[model samples]
Target chain A: MKKWELKPAKDLGLPATERFRSLRRESGLVSTGMQLAWWSMVRGYMAVWHRLQITGKHHIPVQSPFIMVANHASHLDALVLASPLTWRLCDRIFLVAAGDVFFETPMVSAFAAGMLNALPLWRKKCGPRAMGQLRQRLLEEPCSYILFPEGSRSRDGQSTGFKPGLGMLVAETSVPVVPCYLDGSFEAMKPNQRLPRPRKIRLNIGEPVSFETVANQREGWVQIAETMERRVLELAPRRGA
Target chain B: MSPAARDRLFGFSHAFDNPVTLVVTLVVGSLLLLAPMLVWWLAWTGRIDRKMKSELITRYWSWLVITPLILGPILLGAAWTIVGIAILSLLCYREYARATGLFREKAVSAVVVLAIVLRSFAELDHWYRLFVALVPFTVGIIAIVAILRDKPEGYIQRVSLGVLGYVLFGSCLGHLGYLANDQNYRPILILIFLSVELNDIFAFIVGKLLGKRKLAPNTSPKKTVAGAVGALVLTTLLVMGLGSFVFRGTVLAGPGYLAFMGMLISILGQFGDLMLSSIKRDLGVKDMAATIPGHGGLLDRFDSIILVAPGVFHFINYFVGVGADQSVHIFTGG
Candidate 1:
């Protein structure tokens, strides 16, 4: 079945959220084995991230309808985020990814959309068009959006400041901007390394500061960003939910 | 000779020569051959996608057809066809490695070499004694030696750990040792191979037509109460009546025993298939390695062998009347 409605975690009940992502093109009519497989994948990835001890989850909206701004640490940041949030949120969360990166092949896109539920982000000069579409989705449906705060990935995997559009989107939505700092990913699969090591990583989620606060107070976003930076530093060493 | 007539006149070649071998091979080879057509028919009807369909045919059906054709009356090698299983186990392990990320890269070369070494020795005169001791001792030594190397950090541990999967996954191929050494090796192997395939076919045909009740939806969603009984009844009658002609004196101890054994083998085969499916479920993969068209991998294909082996092995052990400690005197039938 084709679904027109993009639902947020807040709108969906816990079980409903868990089941929702499993919906494919043949969503309702899939085989029993496939359905089992979908849910099992969702559960397994979440368990792995949870076992990695992602911290500051306590700071997230038990239900998220906010702008999640994090540094781009690795190619698999989407999956890493998916693995944890699929467990944490009570609803389906969407990540904004560069369209070209994942859309080259047909089956690949279908599968990513089906599994990751990722929405498109534009890296091209006219990226506003993609952001515009995202803006509409957020307004029409109660949705949480994950944004890579840094426009481009930091060469060294350090926490860099906001990309212009991310800050702009944060201002437009007035949603809480939760800064998440990730540690150990750069070392695990360094840019030069061909394969990833199974290294422990921490996702440091900070207390949500409203867009209004950052806009009204000069340097408030930076303070909020600093608070986030410090929080990730604190969260990195601890292995917990 | 033209290929079709050659296939026909040759009676499908080496794997199905003797009357005992022919009957068993007919049952086993045909079922193996038919499985993919059924999958294609299922796919043609839009049951599975193009990716799954192609995967099923190439990975499973191609090997299934080619193995029996190339190996011939050696259809008994259902447990381990030379080029087919050797490659199949490697593919199965590749899927395992990819899914589990257990072995990493460093472990791949060493573990694969050891596994193939074991395969090369599969047809040795003393395969059973060699396999039983060699697998245990060689794997242990390899693990210790690989671990001691310390080629890189995390490499050795992963290599050493890979031995578990290599052994657990590849050991089923060792059933060839038992198959070869059976005094009535050709018939017994073919008989059991066909019986399992028959169990699957009967269960599917009967289950589809009559199954209304769920047997174990959690483990095997397709099976049903009616299907189970139908398989039991069909296999006992069909297998026994056929076995009487093909197996001759060893057909069955009696109708009662044949029915009992047939029913047990059906259940065992079903359980084995389901067990492998469950492993895929746990590991979050589909079709072990996409090696076979309809079947998943060597592990997937031989899922029944591990369970079926004990039953057939014990039955042979008891009938051959070898005391528990005695080496099996493989009844070599030409």
Candidate 2:
């Protein structure tokens, strides 16, 4: 008889409160259902209200263990970037959200963890430990990530220099990092806006960038970040021309 | 629905009518009150270390909270009892799925959950045929759903795990809720729940004091042959003592019959615990989940009850039918 392959849940034994903030968090039926429902609603809202469109949709790979790094602009950037993927992928994709904002309170933490399926990145206290955990999860679970490498949302709709923190995840690994550009999400829902406006939004996915040759060090991370930033910026058309 | 059925379904007023319910309720209530005093005395006398004392206190507090939730529904009505069991079935299923990594198979898990809900409906409607039929029906559905994924590499593993999970948490545990179909379900249920829980306590205490010769060292290191025998004797006595009042007029009134039922409760209850132990041993986890403060998951606390529920239910069912005189198809009338 083949013995039962007993792989207990990765996030088992953690208390509920600890589960929300843990990097080892894994979605079960409830979180999967919630993410599906929430993402479906976001997809619908983007299609109707924002007139969302995606080019180079085929650029996003069908498999996981990849990072979807996009230019941070508005709150809608992550939603717009992640809303187009199939629900199967969406369930595994964790949006690396800011810990201070999304996870400060219990209610928001629940929404962020349950609906958005986000793993928090404590910018203030974010060190190698946090990044190492994220890196470990990406390789161990062989999961994908949707994160803004600029570290925070762009205030004036202009993409900034990509932070090296993104390197901490994909550097020295075979995991592909796909650079993406979000157009008009800033106009739709800026950082200060309480509600998003009905503005047409477009997503441009660039080719997958590999950092396998890049060293897993500070300099290599910076190189990976800069290359990804240049690629994402290249996806956006020149303004007014 | 008939007035009698309505009364049984929603009759909070008659909750205390049965002496078994009254005695069990009072006894459980008193235990809840007196446990803390015992803890404090032990702590005061410095009999237990701080860590052990803290763990015991935490366990007691959780019991204080859990006792009401378990009793409130039964006291309210059979309908509430069924609903409560449905919730428990769902929670237990969730814990099991997560532990076995079966929750990732969304389709099979969904079917399992759907089967559980449907069984709850059957119990509520008093539809015995559907309640009984759900087992094979769900197993077939889970098998089919597993194939829908189209990846056959680990197809057998996935389907079998789903089937086992549904059988353990969904079908087996659901029998406890179905017991509410009996007109005198409150006391019958109280009796079963009380004896099953006390059986665990007996085994634990006895095992601690007199336990030698590990029953199944690979499955459960702490369990002893001596403890198993002790629990069997004590639980059988407790059941016979308390069960006499509940089954006074039934065919199960005699000492011989009562003793048999008690022995079944004790033995089956221990087997249920061993079943979970085997699962945990295979999985190499201590507790199912850290849900309760001092205990493990709801599954850990209620693992023994899962098998005991069906065992006792069917045993009594064979003797004197459950809900024999009660109205059938209370909701979906033929």
Candidate 3:
């Protein structure tokens, strides 16, 4: 007879706000309900208001343990990148957001964790130890993540260089990184704007890139980030020539 | 609701109608009042160190909050009592599910929760038939719901966990809520809760004084055989003293019957405590959750009452049936 497998929740004793920011966070029955409700509302809003269009839905990975990296140009980048995924997968997918903006206050942390199902990336203090914890959660839970590699949202609606910190997450793992580009979200909701405008947005998803062969080091991380950046840049629409 | 039913449901003026209720309330109040002085005395005499002193004080503070939350509802109305138990069932199930990792299975968890709520509704309606029927019906539903997953792997584990959760939290605890259907529910509930809590206190104090041999070391390391025997004797006496007043004119007022009921309360109350300890030991957790500051969890504090509720209810029920004269199906009007 096989042994009965019984494992308790990782974030057992932590309070609500602490659970929200915890790297060891795992969704339970209540949070699953919350995610389903929040994601359905976001999907409806994106469809009706943003008139969001996706060019390559096939490129989205079928299972989790993957990363969706998009060009960071607007506050809506995370929302737009996450909008196309199935609501059934909402509990398994987490949007990695800035700690300062989304998790600095208790109220914002609650909103981010409860509604968005987000984990904080403390950019200023994201040492190797923190990155290692994030990596551990990804592979261990085999969950998916949605992140913008350009660190912060763009003020002028242009994609910046991808940061090498993205390398620390998937440099040597079998998890694939899906490159995506979002156009017109900066106009829809720029960093300076309080509310989003009803501007049409287009999402272009490219094939997933694997870095299993790359060494888990500074040079390998930079190369992986650069390659991912170029793939997202390729998805942008051609300009008049 | 009928006038009679309304009176039973929301009548707060008759909170102290029964002599037993008045006596139990005063005793609880006096204990709470005198607890601090005792703690201070212990601290001043160096009977306990700083950590033990702080833990004892913190536990007292938690009980201060918990006692009122529980007693207030029963004193207010049967409706409030039923609702409070329902909330407790939910919270206890929440802790259990999270600890067992059954919360990951959303479908099974939802079914268990729904069954608990529906059982509470039956209690509130005073519908005895529906209340008793919920256990098997829910067990069947939980078993069938897991088959919907279609994966067929770990189906036994999922179904078994769901059933265990519903039975312990929903049905066992629900018996306490169902007792409120009786006309004299306030005094009866107060008597049972008071004795069960005091049972734990008796065991702790006695064990500290004369505990040498361990009762069940693997299951509960701190429990001693001496503590169990001591609690049985003391708690039986307390129950008989209170039971005589509560059942003054009934057949249960006899010495033989009162002694049996007292023993039942102590013995079953100890079993309940050991039962939760075995569960925690198997799961490899110290406490269920840090819900009550120093008490570990609600389950930790109330474990003795879970089995004692039904045990005492049935024993009294066998000799002189409970709620036999009271109205049944109060809201259903059948």
Return the top candidate by TM-score. 2
> lDDT at B232 for candidate 2?
96
Q: Which stretches of candidate 1 lie over 4 Å from their true place?
A: A1-241, B1-17, B23-85, B105-109, B112-116, B119-123, B138-167, B250-257, B294-300, B321-334
**TM-score of the second chain, cand. 1:** 0.67
| Backbone collision tally, model 3 | 0
Each candidate's fnat: 0.00, 0.88, 0.70
Spell out the clash pairs found in candidate 2: none
**Global Cα lDDT for candidate 3:** 0.88
Provide the clashing-pair count of each candidate structure: 19, 0, 0
Candidate 2 contains a number of clashing pairs equal to 0
- Alpha-carbon runs more than 4 Å astray in model 2: A1-4
- What stretches of model 3 exceed 4 Å from their correct place? B44-47
* Clashing residue pairs, backbone N/CA/C < 3 A, model 3: none
Q: Give the candidate number with the greatest lDDT.
A: 2
Question: How much is the lDDT of residue B293 in candidate 2?
Answer: 84
Instruction: Name the weakest run of 10 consecutive residues (lDDT summed) in model 3 chain B.
Output: B325-334
Q: What's the TM-score of each model vs. the native?
A: 0.46, 0.97, 0.96
**lDDT tens per residue, model 2, A1-241:** 4555668888999998778988888888888988899999999999999989899988888988889988888988889988768877977799999999998888898899999999999999999999999999899878999999888988998777899999888888999999898889888888899999999999999899888899999999999989998999899978889
